[model samples]
Target: SNLETETEKLIQIVLIGQPELDQLLKKNELRQLRQRITISWELLPLNRDETRGYIQHRINVALGKGRVQFSRSAVELIYKYSHGIPRMINVLADRSLLIAYTMNTKKITPKIVRPAVKDVGGLNPLTTWIDSLWKTILPGFLALSILLFGANYLMLPDFNKKNVEEKDLNLIIKENPIIPKNLIISNSQAPIIDLPQSGNLALEKMKPVTPSHQAYTPDDSLTTKLLNPRRIPSTKPLIIS
Candidate 1:
């Protein structure tokens, strides 16, 4: 009965040995199920010569099981990038094959692999980054320049001085009196007119005498007539007193 039970369990067992396959089986097992599998192996990565052979084998398989050629430099570049990982070698070889097909060539070289890898991962130079930065900043710098020029024009003292001078000229012209041509005295040099010292004496000397008073006659209607003219005059008489 024990032998029958052992045979039955052995029939139920599934064999798993590959590293990737074992990892999957371990992940899915219950604790009781996990204890049943005691046998395992830790797979190691390929060495340099194995890596080279792996890369060549994949390239040959991609070329329909025929030989695909590669330069020593190209093999070196592949080894450098893939670093002895079988999966990475397969990925790079597949890409190199596609590049060879597109370029219409059977041989893959370092040049072909370089451009293929570069297409996936490439970096710009520092100069390119700096140039892009300048492009972004240029418009702001230009606008600041324009603003400064406008401010300078507005603040200039010469412009203010000219404006003030024009206003002053207009004001000066407006305030002076207008003199008629006939009233203006035309003299090479203006004459200095002198007056007498005393105000009353100057006034008396400048006064004009009447002609009738200056023409007085004492003989015509005598002194006696002059004294009695008003009493004796039935007619009007002219007398000097």
Candidate 2:
């Protein structure tokens, strides 16, 4: 390949394909074709702001003017549905223009953009709802599933396991004490005692009693102070309300 004649002209070839198809062409298969190629480039779509500028530039070039009128909201809608791709933007912009023209709109507006989006079969609401549902529902469902799985794994018996002996099928059950419903705290036939005429047992109990005489003892350890006790201070008798 390096011993080419001076009269022969060297030609280079460029190949392009989608990201998915790139792996189909192996370096070994294209060795001869790509022998002279020293560089390769990968291009990505523009972002929302960049897409807006891109659409405006295309519109300006097509109309032979510095600017083409597009409402802010309309531009945003276009960017949202187009996903900031140049070719997708062109397609949506063309469709939107057609819709605007038919609807007698001088400049593209959000109202025009909506119908245009719907007409061209834009994003599906059901699919969007499903996506949102997956984001919100799936995680919570999975968490609950995980918790249940862990609990079952920890608490429940494994049916497939062979560790348990078939001969010992009876499991030990705990027995609780049984209480009789008819049991009573006291004997039913027990006689009731009558209250005193005063009907105040606490008052009767609190009443001070007269001091009785203590037996005489000649013990030196027992002083007269011990034999004769100090007088207790009198308190008002309690009156039941």
Give the top-scoring candidate (lDDT): 2
Point out the worst 10-residue segment of candidate 2 by lDDT: 168-177
Model 2, 30-54: lDDT tens per residue? 7665656566676687777898788
TM-score of each: 0.37, 0.44
Roughly what TM-score does model 1 have, to 2 decimal places?
0.37
Clashing residue pairs for model 1: none
Tens-place lDDT digits, model 1, residues 60-156 = 6666555578777787776666655566666676788789899999788998887766664542222335677788888889999999999998887
Give the runs in model 1 whose Cα sits over 4 Å from its true position. Answer: 1-33, 59-67, 119-241
Q: Hey, what RMSD does candidate 2 come out at? A: 16.4
Off by over 4 Å in 2: 1-38, 64-67, 122-241
lDDT at residue 212 of model 1 (Cα atoms): 70
Report the number of the highest-TM-score candidate: 2
lDDT agreement of model 1 with the native: 0.63
